[model samples]
Target: MSQEKPPVPSGRRRGGLLPNARDIKAWEEGGGRGLRGFLRRTIRAYLRWNRALLLDPWIRYRPAVQLLEGQTGDLQRTLDVGSGENGLARFLGREVVGVDLDFPATVRWSNHPATLLRAIRATATALPFRDGAFDTVVSMDMIEHLPTGERPKALREMLRVARRTAIVGFPYGRRSREFDRSALAVERDRGIELGWRQEHVLRGTPGEEFHDEIIRTVGAVRPEMTLSWFGHEGMRGLRLRWRLQFLISKDSRLYGLVFFPLYRLHSRGRPKHGYRRIYVFKKAAGGKPGDRVRRPARNSVRDPD
Candidate 1:
C-alpha cells in the first residue's frame, strides 16, 4: 500500500514576516525617526514573538503542532499528555490542560505564558481526569519516552480521557529507527548530544511488531473508536535537518545567528517517506474505530521521503 502525504489544514494562509532577510530589510527600510519608527519596531517585535512560538522547535516537531492545531479546530477543553516544558497547548492557542511529571519545576524564563498557565503535575500513564473529560487529547512525540511496556498504557490514558478524539505521535516504525540511530552516531562523533535523542537511543523506537500490537489493542478495547495513521519526515529530510543541527552546536551564542536563517530555509516542506508515524484514534458519538471521523483537510503534498 502507498503511504499518504501530510495533510494540510483548511483556510490556512500563514501570514507574517517573510522568512528571508531581503523581505525583512525591505520592511525595515523606512521611517527611522518619530512614531513611525516606533511602530515598525513594535510590529517587528510582534512578528518575532509569533515566529518564536510557532516556528520554533522548527526542525523536528513543527509539523506535529500544525497537524494537531488544524485537526482539533476550536476545541476548548483539550488535554496534552506528557506535555513537557512547552507543550502543544502553547501553539494551539486555546484552553488546554497539560499534564506532565516535571512541569512544576520547569523554569518560566524561556517559556511562553501558555505553557505554564494550565500545566498540571501528572503523568500520562495515570491521567487524573475522569472518563471523557476532554474534547480532544494529544500526546505528541512523547510516546517513545516511555518503556515498551508502558507505551500502550500512556496511549490508553489519553484515550480514556478524550470524549471525541485522541491524537498520538511518535518516532516509530522501521525508518524512524534508522533515522535516530544515524542521528545519534553523528551527534556522538561531535561529542555533543541532544538530550532527547539520547533518550530515543536508550528507550528504542518501536517498529512493526508494536504497530500490530497497538492495532489489536484498540480493535479489541475500543471498538467504537477508529484508528488511522501516516508517516512524515523521511530520511533525506531528517539527514538535512540533522546536519543543520551540528552547524551551530559548538557555540551557544552563535546558535540563533546560524539557526534562524536555516530555520527559514527549512521551515515547511513535504516529506517523501515518514521517519515518524502519527496515529490518530478518533471516537465518533456512538461508533467504534470502524466509524468514520472527518479527515484533516489535505493538499497534494508529496509523501514522506
Candidate 2:
C-alpha cells in the first residue's frame, strides 16, 4: 500500500525559511494583541537584533572584511558599486559613497560608523559617475547576480571609474553537489528551509571561463591592468563548518559563544579551493588620474555616521 507524505509544519509550508506572505497573514490574524503574541514578537525582535549585531559580523562578513583589509591601498575618495546595505563600508572605516539598485527600508544605515557618505541608487552596468571618479572601487558578492552577458559590461564600468584599484569578490569554482547535499541535510535537521531566496542568477561553475572573460573585458580598456587573485584555496572543512554554524545560529544567540573559536581554527589554515575569491585590478600605467577631494553633489543624501 502507498503511504501518505508527512504534513509540513505551518511555518515550513508557508514561509519555508524566512517570513512569508502566509506567515505575515497568520501573525496579523492573531492581532498581536494578546500577551502570548506580544511576548512572541518581543522575543523574535530581540533575537533578530542579536543576530544582526553579534552573529552576522563574524559569520557572514568577516572573510570579505579580512580580504579588503589585507589588500586595500592608501585610503582616499572611494566608491562601492553594488554595495547592498554597505557591508564593506563598515570595514573601510572612512567615508565611502555606496551605490546599489535598491536599498530596503529595514536596513540599519546608522549601524556602521564608517559609512559616513550617502548611498546612491544606481546600476552596476551604468554607474552615474564620471570617468576616473574615485581612487578605489569595491564590488563584493555582487557580480554573479548579473546575466552572464552583462558581467563584462559591469566589470568594464568599474575599471573605467577606478583610477587606482577595483576589487571584486564572488563565489568561485564549480558548485559542489556534495556541499549542497550537506547543507540541505543540516537545514532539514534544523527544521528550516534555507533556500527561500534566489540570489545567484548565473549558475554553473564560475571558474576558468569566468576568470578569462573578466580578463578579456578589463584588458580592452586598461591593457596593462594588473590582475591578482586572493583567497584561492581548497574547501577543506570550511563548508561543513559554515553549514553547522548557520544551523546553530538559527537556534540562539549563544552560537556567538562558539563562533570565534571555530573561526580562529579554520582561518589559521588556507585551503586549496576556497568557495569565494577576490579579484584585484590595479589601474594600467598612463590611465587618467583620479579626482582627489571631489565629493558627491550637494543634493545627495549623506549619512552623518
Candidate 3:
C-alpha cells in the first residue's frame, strides 16, 4: 500500500518550528523490512524506554530546572511560547499558559494530558494575549526553527507581552551546525541502510545573528532592558553524544550498556564553545509602559553560565 501524506495545518503550507505531522507520519511508515524491521522496532522500544527512564529526567529536565534557578522572576503568571509536549507549565508550578501552532497535537502519537489542559493554539509571531498579560515569558528550542527574518518579530511579541522578564534558550554557534551535520549524517546513513529517508526542513541561525537580533528587538521595546546571557554544554561533547546516541540506538541494549557510562563521563567538563545559549531580559527600572529603547551599536558582554 502506498503511504498517505500527512496533512499540514490549515492555512499553513509548511510544518511548524519542530517536527510536524508529516515527520511523524514518515517515521511511522519507515520501519525496516522483515528481520530488520523487527530488530529496529525492538531497539527503538528500548531506546524509548531509556529516554523516558533516564534521559528525560536527568539530561533534559534537570538541566532545565538548573537553568531556571535564580533566573525566573515574578512567576505568578507566565507564558511558554512555542511550547511542545513537555511544556514549561510542568516546571514553573504556577500559572503558565502554553501557546504553540501545534499545541496539544505537537507530539502526534501520544497525548500530553497535562500540557493540553493549559495549552492554546497560537503562533509565536502573533501571540493572542493582551500587553503585559504575563509576568514572565519563556521560549525554548523554538526560535531557530523560524526563518531568520521572522525571529525578531517573535522575540518582539514575547517582550511586548512580558510585564517583567522574558527568557529564551536555543542551540548556538558551532554547536547548532554540528547538531545539524550529525543529524543529517545519521539520517543519510539510515536511508542508505534501511531505504527510509528523513528530511530535516528547518534552517539553523548562527548564535551571533540570533544574539544580535534579540538584543535589537529587546532594545526596541525598552532600550534600557538589562540583558543577561548564559552559555552551557560543551560543543565538542554535545557533537560526540549526538553521533554516539544515533549509532548506539541501532543496537541499544548491547551498546547502551557500554555507551551509557562513557556518555555520562564524556558529557562532563567545560569547553571553549557552548552548545546552548540562554538569554534573560529584564525590564529596566523607571521605564514607563510604552517607552521605546534604541538598539545598542555593539553586543553586550557575556555572563557566566
**Considering every candidate listed, which one attains the maximal lDDT?**
1
> What 10-residue stretch in candidate 3 is worst by lDDT?
192-201
Steric collisions counted per model = 16, 7, 1
* Tens digit per residue, CA lDDT, model 3, 1-305: 99999876454357455333454334445597797476557555755654443432133333444545565446557788876656665554444688887744444213234432367888899999998898778887777777777888898898889888787876677555656666666666766432211211246644676666776777667565777665546666656766676666633444555556655664454333566566777777776433433323343454222
Question: Any residue pairs clashing in model 2, and if so which?
Answer: 233-271, 233-272, 233-273, 233-274, 234-271, 234-272, 234-273
**Among all windows of ten consecutive residues in candidate 1, which has the lowest summed lDDT?**
296-305
Ranking by TM-score: 1, 2, 3
Candidate 2, residues 1-305: lDDT per residue as tens digits? 89997666475454355454455445545536688498457556644564655333343345545555644456477888877674556655666788888887655555663336567889899999888898788887677677777778888899899877777876676543245455667666868665421334224335667777776776677665677664432366566566576666545554534564666565543344565666777764565433221222431232110
lDDT of 1 by residue, 1-305 (tens): 99997653233334543234443444455447677577567556644554454234343455555655555444567887877656665556555677878755653524455343477888788999999898778777887888889987887777788877777777776677777787788778878667888888889887766777777777766678877776555666556756775554523333455556655665456443466667777775567345433233462232222
Alpha-carbon deviation at 301 in model 1, angstroms:
21
Candidate 1: lDDT of 178? 73
Kindly state the number of residue pairs that clash in model 2.
Answer: 7
